[model samples]
Structures are given as C-alpha cells and as structure tokens.
Target: MALDVGMFEGHRVNRAAAERRCATLTTRRSVKKAHQAAWLVNAVRCVDLTTLAGDDTEGRVKRLCAKARKPLASHIEAGLGLSAGELTVGAVCVYPTMVPHAVKALEGSNIPVASVATGFPAGLMPLHLRLEEIRWAVAQGAAEIDIVINRELALTRNWQGLHDEIAAMREACGDAHMKAILATGELETLNNVYSASMVAMQAGADFIKTSTGKESVNATLPVSLTMLRALRDYGMATGHRIGFKPAGGMKQAKEALAWQILMKEELGRDWLNPDLFRFGASSMLGDIERQLEHYVTGRYADSSRHALA
Candidate 1:
C-alpha cells in the first residue's frame, strides 16, 4: 500500500477479455436449490442497505434500520434455518445527518451504522469541512464512513492529490472504517479506475468502492472487475486485506450472486464475507427475499412482500 504514484501506468485491460470473463462469471452456472437459498442468505449478510435520498426522513431511517435487523421476515427466517437475531445485513448506510436516527433504531444490535460523508456523491466541499463531517458522523455513532473521492483529481491526472485526499479522509475517519467510493462511471476509463483504486488503497482506505449509485453509469461488471484487480494487487503488495464494495444499479438477487461469484473467483472465498465485501444497495434485498421465498416454498412471492418500509 505504498504511494505508488505510477502504479497504474502500464496496466492494460483487454476490454473484450474482461467483458467475456465478467459475462462468464455471471452466466456460467447459477447457484440453485438449497445452495441458491444459502447464497441468498449470504447476499443478505453482505448488503449495506442504504438510503441517500434528498427526502430521507427519520421514519424512513427507522424502517431501514428495522429491515437491516431482520432482513428476512420472521417466518421466512425460520424456514431458512435462521431465527430472530440471526441473518442480519452487514450494515445500514445513510447520510451523515441520518446517522443518529439509524444508530438509535439499531441500538443494542450488532448491526453497524455507516454514514456517507465528505459531501457525499460529490465531494466538492472544502476539505476542512469534509473532515469535520466525518467527525460529526462518527460522533453520531457511525461505525463506518463511506467517503467519495474527488473525481476531478483522477480526471485531471492528479494521482498524488487523490492519494493524499483519501489519506486525509481516512485519518478523519479515526476508528470508523473508511470505504473510498471511486465513482467509476465518471473516471471514464479502466486505467483511471485502476489508478484511483491504487491511490485510495495506498492512502489506507479500508475498502475501495465502485460507485455512489447516483452516477448515470454506476458499478458495471467490467468496472467492478478492474477494481477487484486493484484490490487483489493491494492485498498482495501490503499483506493487508482490503474490502471491495460494488454499489449502485445492482438490484436483483441474481445480480448480487454474480458479484459474489466474481469476488469468489478473483479474490477467493474469504472475500465473500461481510467483513471483506459488501453490496451498497437499497432495493436488492426485496428481490433476494422474493427469490428465497420461491426457493423455500415453491411459490413466487411478490417483491412487495419484502418492502423496505
């Protein structure tokens, strides 16, 4: 995780090969029956159920927390060999201002509250204020902070600046684990994505994430594969395990399994856990719940059955 400024210089991605591989990863073999049910349960465990809307409210945050707590409904939980207090999501993510509501709702539970900080989705604020926001969220009981990297730094080829910025954000995060959102859609090229990923990890990001879910093009398979390569490289170079989160536009149970398979293939089985991997998603749980219902009961349930509220 050294500040290898030129680390991304010579890396070449054969788009065809990468695309083919990603396609294969998702389509080669679908997990089914009890195994599919298990994978769905794992998907539930790896989700960072998020709400980053402008209209977010305390009541919305409470419902989100409640969903994170049980994820699967009571009867569904029992049918899947799980019980109350079991099968919760990895964490619940919300805006910095909503951290307190989420924390209060999730109090006494092991579920961690992750706050999006540093101006979030767009890190354009003064660096000082962004740092203060991180402190504010942590003070509100946020155990994890997902900070967006200034895309302009990568857009303008200021690798050093991007690295330092993430480092500062990581420092501001203090004890809360920091997830560096690269916003890959705006990076425009796999090369830039790789460079940004390297710089973020070099600066001590606990996880290098793919998007903000606000981008027009968020978290595509090829972009995700590129980032996974960077994660694997960072781990090998530093002997420290770093996490990877593919956020945005992944809403189906099948889609979650695809990403999980990609992780398993590229980073090994250890990356399948909540500690090393997460899907930053808001609507994916509903689909997974639907699929699980089909698996366990042989009846396809409506997505409405697992509504967030």
Candidate 2:
C-alpha cells in the first residue's frame, strides 16, 4: 500500500523543524563529551573468544577440504590490486598456496596478506599440523592467518579442544594478525555461529570471519549480522577489540560497500579501519577497477586487463 505524501506534509514539516532545533542544541561541549563517552565505551567492549561446541557442529568439513584444492591465482592478484591505491574495504583472505601470489601482487601496497590455515576450509587435521601450516604461511610472508575452527570438536561440545587449537594457531601466527573463520554456512545456525565466534575471540582471534568462500552457502547478511552482534557483545564484556570479515560470494562493489556500511553502523566508527574490517572477495576487484576507470576516463573498460599492476 502506497501512502500519499500530502497527508504527511504537516508532520514532516514539524519533524524537520524539530531536527533543526535539535541540531542547534548540539553544543561543542556536548559534542566533545559525547565523543569521549563513545571512545570509553569502545575501549571497554572489545574482547576475545570464549568457547565452542563440537567437530560436526555443521558437517561441512568435507566441502571446505575440496574447495581448498582449487587454484586461486587470478583472484588473489586481482584482490591485491583492488586495494593497491585507493582506500580499501578490507584485507585479502586467500588459501595458503595462494599467499605468495597475493604477496607479490600487493607488494609495497597497503593491503596485507591474510592466508588460510589449519587445513583451511576444513579443520579436520591434527593440532600440530595446523600450527605448522600457519607457521609456514607466516614464513611465506602472510600478514595474517585465517584459520578454521574444528567444527567437529565444536559439535561434540569439546570447547577445550577448539580453544586449544585456536590458541596454538594464534601463537603460530607470531606477530601476524589471526582471523578465525567460523565457516557459518556449514554451521547453519546463529547459535552455533555465536558460540564459535566467542570461542575464537577468547582464544585470541584478532578477527572473526563469516565464511571461507568455499561452501555452497557462503557469507549471508543474517549470519554476518549475528556474528557482528556477538563480537560487539564480546568486546563490551572484555576490552579487546576484534575484527569481522565476510568472505565468499561477494562479487559486486555494492555488496562490499554494504558490508562496510553494516560494520560501521553496527560496530561504531572505530571498527571501520582496514585492520578491523575486510571483504574476502575473489571477483570484486574487476568491478572496482571498472568503476575507477569510469570515474577517471569517462568510459568503462570491458576488461580489467589494462589496469596497472
């Protein structure tokens, strides 16, 4: 049902006036106080992970394992270029094998490397093996590690096992930032995602990612929102700020922008930094290049091949 604008004109006029009056009431002192208050709140809410459920938490270990075998050279290169000059939405999350390509593509660029570990997409490997994988990626120049939690352990209510693995991976990352992939698509439940997010954060995950981009069901708005909310709550309880990344199936510039907006609105301005937010995209770079070309040249290119490296 569509409503007539004329019917609400009087109310709209009053609302506009009220807004103007309120705007005028925002004194410099009040504004400063508000800013300080927000800063204090942000400082208090940031935190780490807490616990987990079991290994079969979502029954997606096999699927993630398979996608890991696929080649992702082009995607990694493109993602690095997309964030080369202009302000970027986030870090490039890639497979361990693709870390070198990403490093080469983003060399000297501000965009950092985020490589997956712990048998990425699948957390079915042993804890020692996962740690070794993380160490190797870091040695290969990965600026960050996006490791998967043992969903099987989470599903079985083995919170301790999951926590220990995450802690070890975090340590393996050395000085590089660690992002924990929840693989929400496999979990298929907000409750499960929440539990996993809390666990990863408590175990020292610098960021809580939504998916690995390898599942049929990758990042979803609902799942991302839920994870963000959990991170926000966790931050409030602890004092360590955690980042959020929604990877997979994000191919359009608008989709990336939407996630950025969501993160800013839900988590506040402090979370909008690149270190705290990122888009784990595989194909959105071309779209961004096209847009930049159109803005600069007055015409869009059919392909991104001509874009500078």
How much lDDT does each candidate structure score?
0.90, 0.60
Model 2 scores a C-alpha lDDT of 0.60
| lDDT by residue (tens digit), candidate 1, 1-309 | 457866677887777888888878856786879998898899899999999999999999999999998888777887888878878899999998999999999999999999999998889999999999999999999999999999899999888888888898998999999999999999988988888888898899999899999999999899899999988887777798999999999888889888988998999999999999999997989999988888778899877788987
Worst 10 residues of 2 by lDDT: 44-53
lDDT, model 1: 0.90
TM-score of 1: 0.98
For residues 237-291, could you state the per-residue lDDT of candidate 2 as single tens digits?
Answer: 7777898877778766445555555666678887755567766654454454454
Error of 2 at 104 (Å): 5.3
Which residue runs of candidate 1 sit more than 4 Å off their true CA positions? Answer: none
